[model samples]
Target chain A: MNSLIRFIQRVSTTLLFLVLLFLSLWLYISTSYYQKAQFGRLALGLSGRLAERVSGIGQYIRMREANIGLRQENVALKNELEFLRSYITLSDDKTMRYSRLTLFDTLNYSYIMARVVNNTVNHQQNYITLNVGRCDGVEQGMGVVGHDGVVGVVLAASARYSVAISLLNTDFKVSARHRPTSTFGSLWWPGRSYTHVRLAEIPLHVALAVGDTVVTSGHSAIFPRDVPIGSIVGYEIAEGNAYSIDVRLFADFRSLDYVYVVRSADRSERLELEHNFSPNAND
Target chain B: MIKQLLRYLGLAVLLFALQLLVFNNINFHGYVAPYIYPMLLLVLPLSLKHWHLLIIGFACGLLMDVFMHTLGLHATAMLIVAYLRPFVTPSDTSRAYAPGMRMGFRWFLKYALLGILVHHTVLFILEAFTFNNLSITLLRIVLSTIASTLFILILEAMRVNGSER
Candidate 1:
């Protein structure tokens, strides 16, 4: 008994290290899906607050560039609005125009403005922290977008802050359509350049051209349809009959300042119905 | 002893803040972001118990993980470096490991490079969680290690110069 006690005491440091190592590895592996752990939530809140305060300096310095981007986006939106108005007025049928306006009003998505507190593009698994959270109607699984295009999806939301899985993350994959052909495939980051992502499962038969745009397919309730993701830059044949195409992203993740959290009104309902149809459908 | 402890604590806080605020945002070609916080473990008092070293390593890494949203990646890597620190550190037990007048420049550079290499290897590999893209992973590890080593040496030089006065 004396010998056993001495042995245990002598190697106590190694034992403690093993225990801590196991705990950390478990946290890393398990939290890959969603960081729902209580400690994770608490840490996220604390970090978010700190990052928010520190990022203020950066935000102020980049205010002019962000303002210019916003102004350009405003002009583009105004042009789109003008085109829609002319199309409505040119329609000879009054009832058709009224129904078209009603269709626009009944769109299910709403946008909530949020300031990015912390963003990482170099990491294999990148995450962006935003200042808005549950208190501001941000929730898990909601899609986030910048002024230009798709950003990421909210993974977890504390009361006052939320963390998003950036499009640059290897773990993040979104259903996207090749705008020219209307063919759909999965878009994911290849852990390389921050400005580009790869689109897979695009069949070789689908005619693709350089500079072709890629947009969200809206197959899932997370994002609305037709949100611009990127434009195809290059492609080569992969294994089997598919083509691996590289896409240049529209949103500049390195300088992201403001973003919008997309709240889909019927997301829960659609997800619930899909879940009921198949237990593993959501996954 | 109490004053020394307070000084170390302050250093930790300063390094942590610099890592989170400045270094984290410097993504060079979207491949390398130097991690300078590991210097804390490299320069810690050599007399600290093994258990204390391990705990401090884990805590520092956990603090970084919390802010970076990489929950355990940093902690695991930092802990491994902490465990291996004694092996790379100078055999003499009387002094802390730092690039100073007493320590040879070559020896200190070797010590810092080895520590940063191990830390970056463990971190980038585990974060990748796969060997499918081995080339890119290796590029990241190599680039980040070089960048981190350069930063650590510069910081140590500044520290040594300040103390000489």
Candidate 2:
């Protein structure tokens, strides 16, 4: 015991240094492919029940806002139905000809409702827990949107709960476009703010306005084309030839409570196309 | 002893819940974030066995990890912090020891800063594992360290005030 105490006293700092080095290395090695999807599902189930019970006490505080949201959603859905009616003949002909269709098959808007069970907003990479899971047809790679704008993508799902990778995370990347010209670029969070994202790799010639709309570019199957992401708050040209844009997100993260998980019906076929053309497509 | 254990357990629950729900939202200009949960680990008894301290700290961090969805960042940081805590703390047998002790601001500041530095360095590096932007990683370490220390000091002050006669 005396010898052990002496050893710890002598080498504790060095030992700690080594231990930290090892753990940091391990975290780096396993991060990209290390997904605990099943664990997330079970955790979601437990947290869902717990959040429900706890939130029940404060449900009254949120009732009014929720009601307002529902009424607005109803109005939006009605308008969407009216728009679809205007395009029903074209959609019918397109649907009959194309055996495989995508959610972006048309400019129509559809949504998958989900409740926020657990949420963390103050991390470099933040994730939200949703009550809808695989049982509710929620799947990985689907986009999650709030009433205002893009929330995140479904990273993992279990039977009763799923995990969303928020737009605020540094690890999250999306193909986005500016309105009017429809020029393409990538949208990513710099992990510095909840209200903005850094739009990368746009050419300097692409015209941009301070309040121009940023929407999903439809380059991927996760989100449909023209789903609102944010508005251009500002822009700066890098030392290189690219224009970096600052987008102010429409989602008020502090008041975020509900979301819609968007799944493309043709996810597998679109993935197949990208896989065939690309050298390393499996990621 | 059982009652005290229950009290601490309840406190742990409250800390974790509050940290996730309330405190996580209170980002002060994206530079400072309060880490009040570590107080649960900090206030643990001084006489605990070294291995036990390591285990408890691991569990404490694991709980936080489960909520944050980062598998091992907090666990790894907390373990090292726990292992090194006793040495950095004012030794009871040394000249710095004061009996019937209330650890003052200076001592708490030094101790908490050291621990936060260690924790944030490991965490930020782990998050930015690719060495993509070493400067940004360093910035995170400094910013998070300052934030956590501020949190620890504020909580300590509040505790001292409430307990003072």
Candidate 3:
């Protein structure tokens, strides 16, 4: 017993290191999947406020660039409004049940406006912090988009703040199809180049041209279909007869200031159907 | 003792604010972020208990993980470097330096860079979680190490020159 105690005392540093390594690995794997634990929520609540204040200071310095981003978004929104407006027909007849509801009456998705309090593009797995959360109708898996296009999906949220997995993150992939022929592929971050991502799994038979637009397939309940993602800039065929495409993203993640968190009201309904097919469908 | 602890705590909070607010927003392309928070562990006194160092490592990393939404990845890497730090560091018996005391330039650079290397290696590996692109991950580790270590050394030099508070 005495010898065991002596040995423990002699090598306690190394021992403590192993012990700590174990504890840390345990803690790491637990949160690797982004479970909304209490500690994460509390830490985010505290740091989110501080970051919000600090970023507010930088907001002044970049007001011009920020204004451009906002204006670009406004122009995009205006264009969308123009497109939607074109679809509406003026009917003075009494039988028309409520005029001016044609374009929006079938919208299964609603948007929650939020400001980007914090953002990053450097890490392999980057996350964006938003100034809105559960109380504001932001939830896990909600899609966030700027004026240009997709920003990311909500990872977790607190009462007043939320963190989202940026499209830059490797773990995040969006199903997209070329706008011309609707050839589908998956978009990946490529772990480098903030402005470009590699669109993988494109079959060689699918005709792809430079400047081809990539938009969401709407196959997943996370995001709506036909949402613009990026445009094809370059591509090369792999040895296995697959096209590795380089896409120029429309949304500038580095300068994200304002975004809208949107979720389909039918998301639950879609997932419920999958759940019937597979009990662990959500997982 | 309480005053010193308070000072250390204040520095931790300040560095964290700088990290989350300024550094987090600065990314030279992708996979090249300067991680300055681990410097808190690097500059601790040699005489401080190793267990205490481990605790601080976990806390610093956990704080970052919480804010960044990586869960426990940072904490794990922080713990690894903190545990290995004392072994790799030069022996400092009879020196009696304070925890945050500025060191000689050459020695400080070597020490900080070593710690940053160890920390970044573990961080990028775990962050990658899989050896999918070994080359890119290694490049990220090395580049981030240089960037973070250089930033820390400059910060330390400034502190040493400006009254060493």
* Highest-DockQ candidate: 3
DockQ, Cα level, model 3: 0.65
True contacts kept of each: 0.58, 0.19, 0.73
Number of clashes in every candidate structure?
Answer: 0, 0, 0
Give lDDT tens digits, candidate 2, residues A1-283: 9999888865775565566546644653576522633344546666666665655665678778877877887899799988766655456677653533443365344567888766656677788778888889988888998876788888888777788888877788999988778999999988767788889888999888899999889888888788788999899998689998999987767557778998766687778888898988666
TM-score of 1: 0.92
What are the TM-scores, per candidate, against the unseen true structure?
A: 0.92, 0.80, 0.90
Whichever of 1 and 2 has more lDDT, that candidate is 1
- By descending TM-score, how would the candidates be arranged? 1, 3, 2
List candidate 2 stretches off by more than 4 Å.
Answer: A1-5, A8-17, A33-42, A55-73, A87-110, A281-283, B1-10, B93-110, B117-165
Badly placed stretches (over 4 Å) of model 3 are A1-6, A36-39, A90-104, A239-241, A279-283, B90-92, B99-103, B161-165
Please list the C-alpha lDDT of all candidates, in the order they appear: 0.87, 0.73, 0.81
Residue B57, candidate 2: how far off, in angstroms?
2.3
Give one digit per residue, the lDDT tens place, for model 2 in B1-165. Answer: 788578569768877876776666566555455566777777666656556667777778766776677766777877877777777655664443321126666777777787778877877777665587687668767877887788777766765566475
Query: Per-residue lDDT for A2-58 in model 1, tens only?
Result: 999878865997898899899888878887646632345667777789899999988
